[model samples]
Target chain A: MAGLLDGFLELLDVLLRNRVRTVMTALSVAWGIFVLVVLLGLGRGLENNVRWMYRDDAVNSIWVYRGRRTIPYQGHPVGERLRYTNRDHELVEARVDGLEKISSRFYPPIPDSVRWQGKIVAADFRAVHPDHRYLENTLVETGRFLDEADLLEKRKVAVIGVQIVGTLFGDHPPIGEWIDIGGAMFKVVGTFRDVGGVNEESQIYLPITTAQASFAGADRVDQVMFTIDDAHMADAVAIEDEVREMLSRAHGVSPADRRAVRIRNNVEEFVRVQSIFDMLAAFVWLVGAGTVAAGIVGVSNILLVSVKERTQEIGLRKALGATPGSIVRMILAEALLLTGTAGYAGLIAGLLVVEGLRRWVPENDYIRDPDIELSTAVGALVLLVVAGCLGGLVPAWRAATLDPIVALREE
Target chain B: MIRLVGIDKTYRVGAHPLHVLKGLHLTVPPGELLAIMGSSGSGKSTLLNILGILDGYDGGEYWLGDALVKDLSERKAADYRNRFLGFVFQSFHLLPFKTALENVALPLYYQGVSRKERLRRAAEHLDQVGLSDWSGHLPGELSGGQKQRVAIARALVTRPRVMLADEPTGALDSVTTQEIMDLLKRVNAEGMTIVVVTHESDIAEQCARTVFLKDGRFEGER
Candidate 1:
């Protein structure tokens, strides 16, 4: 409720009186804020990298891989491990409540030499269910996804990705063309365009029945993937466990032998990764807060010295009948001026550094480009003001509590 | 009017206490010009500090106008100083950063006067001290005598009941010192009480009465 203009003018006067001190204090604050922003940006970049690794895959989908179990049976460890059959997949599909979409995969162990027209191309072929379109998040740019009719009819048809088409046909419209896969002819039912190389576009896909009869030759499948509904993560996990129990009972495999049948839940993976990122962010904040505290300490030390040097001036004012409150305000104003200026300077310098790094640095390299977000700027300003106030309080108290006679005698 | 009865002040250095004012008694009616002449360590500055309410006294009954100056709290002491006392230092403590006009207006500012009124009064006081033309000049830009005139103008701007000058002419030349004394005399004749502290007998002779101090007690009245 005091005269704000007077306080502001007085603050300007103190800062002007000690230009070097003021600038130094401001620089420290600015550097502190800069470090904080840079740290946050680094954390965000790391999170982005992790997300990039999982792109083209369902974040909400779970995969059940074929694994081996090492358990003792009859005083010797069991060998070769148990294998999953189609019946286990069917049992889970019937009982699991949160099954949004499901797909099974079977890869041919040997590579296929495919021939189109007069060209030959190497292909690692797989037979995947049609629901793979949903689980793999694919877009059929040129043609369309394989239908359930294709699976039931057991047709000798192929869904070829754009890369395979480029390798085999070479600028030719490949649809309806016959391709020779391991001496057997199959029609290219669809040609797929590029979908970031991480999806079904990476290879050739055929009917599960054809793949089982041809290259892989074994009747057993390789893996199954289930995409769960986003809203059913918590309840679906427990239900998935029940489905696993049912499948284990049906397959007559021990529940403890994980190799018999392996199950994964995306919600669990998401929770684990989320916690790791949280911890990383907390560590970054710790370092940033420490840097900010160091800057505050530097400002406070300079302010204390400034107050000491101005003792005689304070005495003269008191002798002229300046109230204690005014003296306190004067010292506080000086502190605020020093810290606030330095904080803003630090912010600008930090942003400049971040921008330079962003422009000059390459992607996927060290030292992520800092983001000067609005929230970060506001947070830094608030921290600086608080630091300034705490820094000024002691010196201001001393000045306000000064005895005029003692101060005048301070030569 | 100012009156002092058995005012005592002591300073504690290390373990020993040095009494600077030993049961001192004095009085000065309105419009009187008085001087206290004392050598170094003879308590002249201490007495001035006590009278200005800038220092606390051990025991005393000091009154200015109808108010008791001694035994007042810090805030009230400040109020008393602002209401009735003005000071001029030998070093011309005119706040070197400010112009003469700004320095002269400070006391009135503390008195809560309007800025326009304070500036107008400060201008008049500067004209009285014959530094109307130097109002815009900082203390560093002015001569020693001109600085003293500014300081005198600052002291009198509030129209205090008493003006205290601690060796007001200590830093000036003989001619400038005479000029400052003449100004003080003119101000006293205009009905403002004045007390000056100086070791120079010539400066003391300019006032109507002079008191000499030795060993923390008044030696005799002159």
Candidate 2:
């Protein structure tokens, strides 16, 4: 321990003697680590914001909406529109292999109203199967959602959104209570919340059979959506193609007419955007590591200069019984000291800058919560120290291998 | 005590080899003060290097006391240099950044001496060299003679079997060179074996024995 302290003091003196050079080398190292931390934080922020954008819906869902045929098909004109019938939902559920859940949506042709105890609120009403709970990311706050029994019996039951309850029932629980919709009375089965915010929370749900019989949707489904489990873009695209082929064939739509059977594959889109972020992360690391490497070159250069300037002194030391290993150790210790202190300072500065942005800057759709994890920070610092050691290697070796006779005669 | 038998050394200067020492022979018994005199290219420095174990010989037998000193590994050679020899150079070669006390204490440090003991012995050696008051001064702050005194103090602190002085006074003036020579004579009187290499006849005359070199061979001794 004493020897180590003595050696450390010796190296400190050497560094202090060359203060300007040490500081310059340290600044370059500091900049390298700072750039790394900031870029990583930015990449992570972009990823967080994107994930948040899809927070309200299942990431792997495919939503198929109504479309008009833009191209003429066999015996059909180009302007003819296409509609999804109730049979299409059964066929898709049976034919799709990777699907985890499926739901068909129906809506009243015009905006609707619900009245309870003379409290009137205009809101959206959706008719869907029970699986719609998972697709819309809804949390049933109390009571139950539409079930197989409700749809089978065509019961006059409703699952009300939390906002609708807030407007109509106020503080009262709406379960098992009656609400009037379009002059028809339905019992409230549940009150549910959605992360999709007020618009989704204001909507209400009904069994497909009950809504069809009441509002005359002609046994038709206005839209279809399904969730896939653990499949990537390729699997989602394949499922989409199968549904399009089935629908287009039954509707006489042309094979090349994509607009007639519009499909939005969230799985594919989500995977594609996530991969772009992955590339951005790789790019950030590359630029960060390259900057650190350039700083290492500066370290190596300074050590070489230190060794060159001390040639005669080294010769004298060797003659005084200083071994080659001791010489190497001394130089390496100096290099480590310079980088360790500077890199730590830069890391703290970078983290402070990121924290400042997180607190002061308003978040948007493109970025939120710019930061790095603890493990990443520690790993980056370790990498910087290893680079510093590598930077010292050549100079230390050269100093150790010097011929005392030659070095002494250098003057 | 020192012994050299038929030492041959060659230098590779570009494509051609320059033979510096050719079949040279010499010996000095214990406690002898010896001087080797030669002009440049006569291989006096090469002989000193061989004696110091800082360079290898092409062909030779060198025995310092009872130990044969040839073909030793660098680590072993360093140990031998640390334990058995001390060197004084023409330039004084004191570390410019270190104080006189620190420079003198350096050899003891390499010997694994602890700091307190190293400083104490260093102070004693500084007193012996008549520079105790300048022990805290850096080499840059000292005169040429004072710096040489510090270097001599550093060399003697280890109390090795032999002290090799390679043109030790080449950088000093006439009066200071005399003072340095007096210090060396005092050290020799205390029974430490010493060898001084110089081209100056006046410096050679101060030694107990002076050997002249012509080419790589010893011409004669007076």
Considering only chain B, report the TM-score of model 1. 0.97
> What value does the lDDT take at residue A294 in candidate 1?
78
User: Would you list the clashing residue pairs of candidate 1?
Assistant: A26-A342, A30-A346
* Residue A347 Cα positional deviation in candidate 2, in Å, after optimal superposition: 2.1
Per-residue lDDT for B1-222 in model 2, tens only?
A: 999999999999999999889898899999999999999989988899989989989998999999999998888888889889989989988887788999999899888777888999999999999999998888889999999889888889989999999999999999999999999999999999999999999999999999998788899999
lDDT of 2 at A196: 97
Off by over 4 Å in 1: A58-62, A67-87, A90-199, A202-222, A226-283, A367-369, B11-17, B114-117
DockQ, every prediction? 0.34, 0.51
Position B172, candidate 2: lDDT: 95
For every candidate structure, what is the RMSD over all alpha carbons to the true structure, in angstroms? Answer: 6.3, 3.5
Write one digit per residue (lDDT tens) for candidate 1, span A328-355.
8777777776677767766776677667
Q: Report model 1's TM-score to 2 decimal places.
A: 0.76
Question: How would you encode candidate 1's per-residue C-alpha lDDT over B51-158 as one tens digit per residue?
Answer: 898877899788888888777776777777877898988888777777899889888767767667778999999999999999998888999999989988988887
**TM-score versus the correct structure, for each prediction:** 0.76, 0.88
